[model samples]
Target: MTYDFQDRVFLITGAASGIGRATALKLSSLGASLALCDINSTSLVTTTSLCTGSHFTHSFDIASSSECTHFIKDTISLYGKIDGIFNCAGINPTSIPLEDTTDEYWDMMVNTNLKGTYNITRAAIPFLKSGSSFVNVSSICGLHPFPTFAIYCATKYAITGFSKSMALELGPKGIRVNVLAPGFIDTPTNSGVIAGEEGVKSLEAKVSLGRLGSAEECADVVAFLFSDGARYMNGSVVEVNGGTAES
Candidate 1:
């Protein structure tokens, strides 16, 4: 389905690569103005180069509230208003058992995955006008148990809960919120998982579709949620996992 975002402005975190980059390209093609954020300035430039519309790029760590506030302020200053936000900035945890998870590892996952989502969404809420929307990227781990991904699962589970609550709180004001749960997407984030033939086969076997998903495929769902097509979808968790973890 084709979506028209001619005059809309969108704020996207983690736009440097993976699903975020794909979403940026998709929305840009649909004629939307963009405010892209990423901590990696170099990779972000590459993403901006591939996009085809008016856009501004900001480099900042989303875990910092001050940076998030500044990024939102600057985005509004440049675009005048934000019509949607895609909270796709996140970190993948190593497949280590919870008992082996160190304090540093735990902190990094919580800060980047959970706290970062909170920081960005809290900062942008004031500027999100009526008819605006927010899409938070969770994971298949959020909805089902993954043996060695306890910490990662915790963060994504928190995101699912947080997005739902935000939808209720913001829905009455005309701002919609939803979550996207993606599984084994073929992106830099899963480079290790698809590194060797054995790894690829093992991962694919877990998916009902017998293959991994692509970043663009996940982006399609994100674009739909951000468009008027999903106007009635709020506090919903849409899975883009190739039938993995079906329940």
Candidate 2:
């Protein structure tokens, strides 16, 4: 599991917790320096604390276009180059039905999940050298419908399509782009919502593996994708779900 990315730089958003936090630590273990971004300053600090000091952190709103510009400028200026970029900052649209959904909620989901990713990747391309990787965090919801999560799923679907198109456009530059779609991962924030006794049983029943996923497990796949091991893998959607969704 050793990645030969020593001294390489990776920029990751949503690094404060969950999958983002796990990936940050995992990449650090593989010897990559990092520029971490998140809105949660307190939690973002904690995430960087788990890594080597060869990391810089920014507490900027991913939903803000101006802030995204400034964040990218600072990272490139500070690190000189970026070898990988992981777009993970996103909001889960509220579970209210479409009729009850507000303009604010729809805008929030689109801004954070869709526009935010566009901002960073678009800005970082000039800073990335050839053979760099771009990994966007998509979800199973993007592929399969979940009741009451329309906008959330839509954003993810857009990311999936967008990643494929970008992969082709950037391939000539030797920059690779891929998406990771994780299903039913058990993180602290989602523990209560998806991990109670009844909830757990229902989720387990839905998956052939009969269990939930862990953030650390998903991180492993992403680490490989970001490394030379996944060199031929571009314009791909790697599903980490436990046989819960079928192609």
Candidate 3:
């Protein structure tokens, strides 16, 4: 479907790579003005260079509520208004037993994955008007547990619930909130998790499509969520997992 966003403005986190970069490029192609952020300044600049249309990039920690507040201020200062937000900044650590996980690890994961999303939402709420969309990136693990990934799963699950509640709270204002539960996508974020070719095959076996999803494929969904095509969708959890099934 064609989406024309000629004058719309969007805020995207984790814009350096993976689904975030892909979504930035997608929205840019659709003529949306963008405010992109990531902790990785270098790669974020690279992603900006690759996109079309007017865009601004910032490097900051989304886990910091203060930084997140500053980010919204900067974006509103530049664009005057926000029409959409994509909360994609997060961490994905490899599987480790619950006993092996420590409080520090839990803190890091929750702060980055869960708190980061909350920070962005809270900061942007006032500026978002009717018809605005918010798409938060969760994971298949959020719905289905992954052994040895308890901490990560906890963060994602929290995002799902938080986003749903926000949808309920914001729906009356015409601001839509939704989530993307992506499976094994072929992105840098998952490069370390998939091991080698054998591991890839093993993972693919769990997906009915017999292949990992792509960042661009997920980007398409984000664009749709922000477009009129999905205007009626709110508080929805759309899974882009290539039909992944439980073992």
Give the Cα lDDT of each candidate. 0.91, 0.87, 0.92
Error of 3 at 239 (Å): 0.4
Residues 1-247, model 2: lDDT tens digits: 7776687989999999899999999999888889999999999999998985569999988878788888888988988888899998887545678888889888988988999999998888777789899999898887788888889889999999999999999999999999999887777655324447786777677788978899999899999899888999999999998889543
TM-score of each: 0.97, 0.95, 0.97
Q: Tell me the tens digit of each residue's lDDT in model 3 across 80-195.
A: 99999999999987778999989999988999899999999999999889999899999998898888899999999999999999999999999999999999998877843458
Clashing pairs in 3: none
TM-score of 1: 0.97
Best model number under lDDT:
3
For candidate 3, report its TM-score.
0.97
RMSD of each candidate relative to the true structure: 1.3, 1.7, 1.1
**Per-residue lDDT of model 1, residues 171-220, tens digit only:** 99999999999988878778446467787787788888999899999988
* Candidate 2 RMSD to the real structure: 1.7
Candidate 1 local distance difference test against the native: 0.91
Evaluated against the true structure, the overall lDDT of model 2 is: 0.87
